[model samples]
Target: MSWSDRQSPIVAVATAPGRGAVGIVRVSGRGVAPLAQALTGRTLLPRVATYGPFLDADGQAIDHGLALYFPGPHSYTGEDVLELQGHGGPVVLQLLVARCLTAAAAPDAATGRPVLPGLRLAQPGEFTERAFLNDKIDLAQAEAIADLIDASTEAAARSATRSLGGAFSHEVNALRDGLIHLRMLVEATLDFPEEEIDFLEKANARGKLDGLQAALQGVMRQARQGALLREGLQVVLAGQPNAGKSSLLNALAGAELAIVTPIAGTTRDKVSETIQIEGVPLKVIDTAGLRADHETSDEVERIGMARSWEAIGQADAVLFLHDLSRMAEPAYAAADAEIAQRLGEALAGASTVIHVFNKADAVATEAVATHLAAPPAPAGQAVALSARTGEGLDSLRQRLLDMAGWQHQTEGLFMARQRHVQALGEAAEHLALAQAHAAQQDGALDLLAEELRLSHDALGRITGAFSADDLLGEIFSRFCIGK
Candidate 1:
């Protein structure tokens, strides 16, 4: 929160630790020109790569590599920066870092100012944080830097890149700009109390609010898609033993990830696979089957069932699979009904539970028809598919994507975290409230102004035009060290 904390010169290992093709010791702050001179034994030209041996405190060669210097105001972090690109060996990088810190603490011969003292090792995401502080990039772009680095799928990576390039921020700022203009119009009219109504009517405030709402709805829809990319969806595959849970898991993953067997209770533990469904990451957890009190006797099976319930509790979606082949048996139907009851109770209506009737290929035609006519799920939509034959899987995939609020789009998606989505939702709420105030019978200009301000603030938080110190700390703290 202090000026010294954000502006202090910092150093870090910019490359991954371990023997890579090369490593870089990055330094950023004021007086980096002198710091570079001290380390390389030669003045580094701005934005130029000069080959040299990185020097120690005693002017000895530490390692031969390239030294690049970028002067302040036009570089990353908006500060004078220096990079010592050396061999990927760990010791050499550490030695270079030590020498920079030592130089920073030592006073210069010509000038009384120390080379660049207080240039300590950077905390996690300090460089990107500094960039944000210096106006080189906004907070959303700063977050995108981390998101891009930690992307789990190609789609996620691309969206992160788009966000980093300001696609998402531009849209939000445009919405904010519109809101600001409207606020200005409304508040300006407040000064002329007698003509306020006439001004609002001429300005068409309601129409402008409606336009803003339309824009916000579009942005929120895109943000929801982007959120799906970021958080993905966790789906748990659960049913009775040998109800084709493992078969469905294998079919979805397109691999033999789970062992299939004719004997009941073969899968006594959970098997998981993360598959991309139309570019949306879907984590499918195949859990051990639930059993009635009299059916499960083995201790291991009990433990597995406990774990199955635990997984179900945490899932975003629950695929309650049923074996259609056994639908004619009353005991089987009773057991499934009991499990469904428990699922309804355990789920608490948070997770999207889909009652999936599996083994359609192996079932009799009449039985499949009857079961389809009267599915047993009390709280979820029903899906019928054959795991072994891979029938109706496309529809299942589409259903899962739909449950997660995923909309298939080749473009226009930028990665967004849950906070971004929440902020947008709040902004939308305020916008709607502003419209409500404006449409009041007597009109409430002051209240309308207040609502518009709230909407603006909410949108501002997305780009960090309005942010709390603790929020910045939390956002940057999640980044990996040296980012």
Candidate 2:
């Protein structure tokens, strides 16, 4: 949006678009008091909820509601804000919004001009974006507002709340402060080339760099976990028909989410469930069995297999299940080998593949151990379990948590996005370069200073201290309207 568009007074239905106990129409911009007075037919006490009838252009009561006014530089958008809370029916809310527009456009008796010129409807996330722009909150906290709304688990919600409360931004600012101090020391020493190294040593620049790197690593680790919580892993199950793929999904989810049967090719489409392990959400997908295309003359089975491969290719992890009971059959073994080769080609090391040996109850203990000893696909982790008995499921859950890099600690953790993680990664890379420079016997003070600056800039991106307009637009655009 242009500067003028942002400057215009904006209004939106603040509550969700549905029937509820109450609904709200929120307006924010400079000089909104007149609009408030015009809407309510009376001057509203600042920050006070005064029950009154919202008036129309003809001075008729559109709806009876509570009118609240907040003066500029203190409200959510750092502008004068007016809120009208009424009944939650969608029709009434829209009527109130329409009244607001009409009232804003109507001419005033004093100057015979629109009461609130340039009043418009708010775009998605414009309110929160204004909060960020006004310094009421940082970019990270603004993102946390959406994260909190979209959080799927209790842990995720708590983490998002922490982030919205500025826990993550505080840590990032602390790191940036340290980097600034170290950069000051290094840049100041660059003026005296002869004593640059001695000055850095005396100022403990090397020790400070080490400390920043350590702190960055700690933050990086937590950010990874937070990102995992935000964007959970996609795990796809693949194997030959009747290899217990559906049964395994049911077992992991602890519910019969997928229909399991002795018949082959029962699941012609993907059946997915999101299960949480140690607060980390894992979307487990059960796909149709992989078989020779010629073996299935049915077009639906062929299409299902194609989609299964598609899911596998896009998955964060693929569970290549093996039926221990069928491993002894020559045809089954050959088919498993072919599927493994295709899986290897399909994934191309882009995703991890876990070898799951199912139906252990139907196989001998020695046989299960032998297969587990050397899985068909030796690259990823292997597990032997019985889906029907729910045996060894804990081990699989732990494996997933390990793959997610979850340390099982949620306290004080702040929700983070992939961009935040990438920014931290970039900062860490620069910090590593700074360390390499400092380790040199005759370190290049200029190069070291440049690295420190780059790292600081990277950290600044997280809090929006150094952010592009496009990035800001992209981040806030995902938020719901009126946020």
Candidate 3:
């Protein structure tokens, strides 16, 4: 290992900033030895934690602690690094940091000028960036570090650890290399067409393309599931007036978030809550019940209904509470057939709906049981108990978790935003298109090659091989100042 020629001596409080038993000020750059020597007023050894007193301008003891020296290329950031451990008092650490900054600013004794390319405070994720620049870790692995830090659930943390161990990057690189091989074969076939070769007709080419597509599909499936587990589920509750929508919200949230009354249009707005089902985060939204007419202004009801449908459109899953008890009322029971006939077409387009038979405690009859069990939530749907008594809530929770694709062992996932998922999806689409084109006997091979190129570039963006400066800035800017 050799020092990164582009490295600068960066310093920061590697440990959390606050009062504790100890605080460490880390410095990394070309001149770590001299910097430590100036600060501690003693010779330092590599990989050894030596106890010493960090000094002030006048040789006064600022703090007595430990000093560790790590020679370049074998340490974090692949640069010469030094760590000064001292008492965790805020003022003491501040002074120590100031002293190190001043010392690192001085010229190297051999050069008699600034040999350290200016010891600046490390930027948020700068150390990790350096690691990536030096080939110590890839961009995906570096991002995993932040995910591990910001993980909201145990499952998320587990997945982040897997990513940090290179699970996600390994899978991506494998796919990328496979794509390269496929492209090589296709390009070779195209270049040597004079040999009367039928590349498309060749079993080798067909088998390779099929296998590549299958592998890509498998990766896409896992990526989608991993992304869902990382991001969690967003569920929206929508139904008609007095459908016990607010009650269901409260039941799911385990608290009264929205006002529930006998009033048909009591909730003329939207309310949202976050609840965990089997440790999977579910963002539940309760909207104003949809109705034909309202005493409230039509404008208000219109906006509420619009928002309800908006939620339904964006939701990963929906819980349509039908209020079976109310539906079974004598006035309602007579028109059930007619209403079902009309509602059939509307429900068909819903992405994923869990036909929750709310208020089950009130309608615990044989007919209701048979009707509820008859459909099985239509393959990813569920029917459960009272939003009031919390009955069958466990089953509902499990169903929601299952829909989110949350697994008991949530390993090998990294926290990714909607943007990353979109890019990967687009790449997968292009790859699919390329496969489709390649399967043809006498088709536009150039178009297929172009799609493969586009797909490769899309994957390149994940590791930042094809990212812009603004994107990097935007990503690191979101981190805490001392990260």
Candidate 4:
């Protein structure tokens, strides 16, 4: 539809609210030029910023500022656009908006339509939505616009910029093309009994399936890493009493964020700190030490341990700490073996664990070397470090960054939300189902096609190509109104 024919012009403050050096009031759609002309008392040249007085109905200047115009199909929202850059006072900007609204609602002769009869202030992201509808950008790129706006870190911003540049859409489109080819092959095999090639019989069927799965998995991993970079990872420190868990927390954060003591169970609660390792955000938790005794009437201790277990279950990674120096200390020597056994069982099913041998500064020479040579825990994959002295922290930091799947040279990475991850996961699941269906004898072509279609549509929703109206509302509502 032509910009002029669809509704009327929409206006909004494109700048942040409140006091600032400048505030921009933006209007787009058929009435933009007419609105500007009415307020400025002159015609606007395309793409040019003109010094003008924004005037009201009585020709009284509301605000003196620069006015810029972008004619339809070439501007943001692919509509005729006008921008009034005025002083940032809230009251003054409101008056400026009133002046434009009044002027834009005037009648026009050429189209025999009211210049802005149906125009109203835009809802959040409406202008961007109009731009998408007008084919200014695809859905994925449109979402990237919001990502770019909300990006919290430099890496995230760069990734969003790349997605806006079409990196993400290109990958999805490439995968879709592959799915199409596979579907075509399946269809051909079903329809042509005498066809020279049998797709199912071809040894390459398995290979193709493997390749597709690998590609999807790789993309999923990268997307997940991107999501983590955007959202951060939650890590919980869990271990027996006096395992140096608090010390490790402080070490990782490079701050005295948690209290540390030689006494058993000094920390009867959870302490959390946000830290970044190589720019990868982490929510690090220092939890109460895990113990099995119930004789003591410490309800808070029980609650803390329960909360720690909960954190462990939810964590992306766990730091299961052990005090090497303490194992040799007479006070802890009697219980060392029991604690070690418990530690092994506690961390057995963890998604990932870094066995940390803390208090390296005081360990005996031979014992220290042997422990340092050994892994972080029973797994022998541990790092021996003095959390108090900050020794061996660089290695631990690198390991955390590696776990985050971040490379310093992040060229193609793009920030994604957990919602995007879930959608991609669903798409991947459907594709696997389709592959399995295709592999079956007398395979259900209809089922395979349906699954493939669902997969494609899921990918489309990531970019807004297949988004529901409500999803758009949810996404844009989170944005500042001025955005």
Work out the TM-score per prediction: 0.95, 0.96, 0.78, 0.78
Taking the tens digit of each residue's C-alpha lDDT, what string does model 3 give over 155-199? 677777877787877777777887787677677767887876666
In the range 212-257, model 1's lDDT, one tens digit per residue, is: 9999999998988888897889999999988999999999999999
3 or 4, greater by lDDT: 4
Model 2 lDDT per residue over 29-97, tens place: 988988998988788889899998988878888889899999989899999999999988999999999
Off by over 4 Å in 2: 191-197, 377-380
Give the local distance difference test score of model 4: 0.76
Model number with the top TM-score:
2
- Ranking of predictions according to lDDT: 2, 1, 4, 3
With a 3 Å backbone cut-off (N, CA, C), the pairs that clash in candidate 2 are none
Alpha carbon deviation, residue 171, candidate 1 (Å) = 0.9
For model 4, give the 10-residue run with minimal summed lDDT: 331-340
RMSD of 4: 4.8
The TM-score between candidate 1 and the true structure equals 0.95
Worst lDDT window (10 residues) for model 2?
A: 192-201
Shift of residue 472 alpha carbon in model 1, Å:
0.5
Best by lDDT: 2
How many clashes would you count in candidate 3? 2
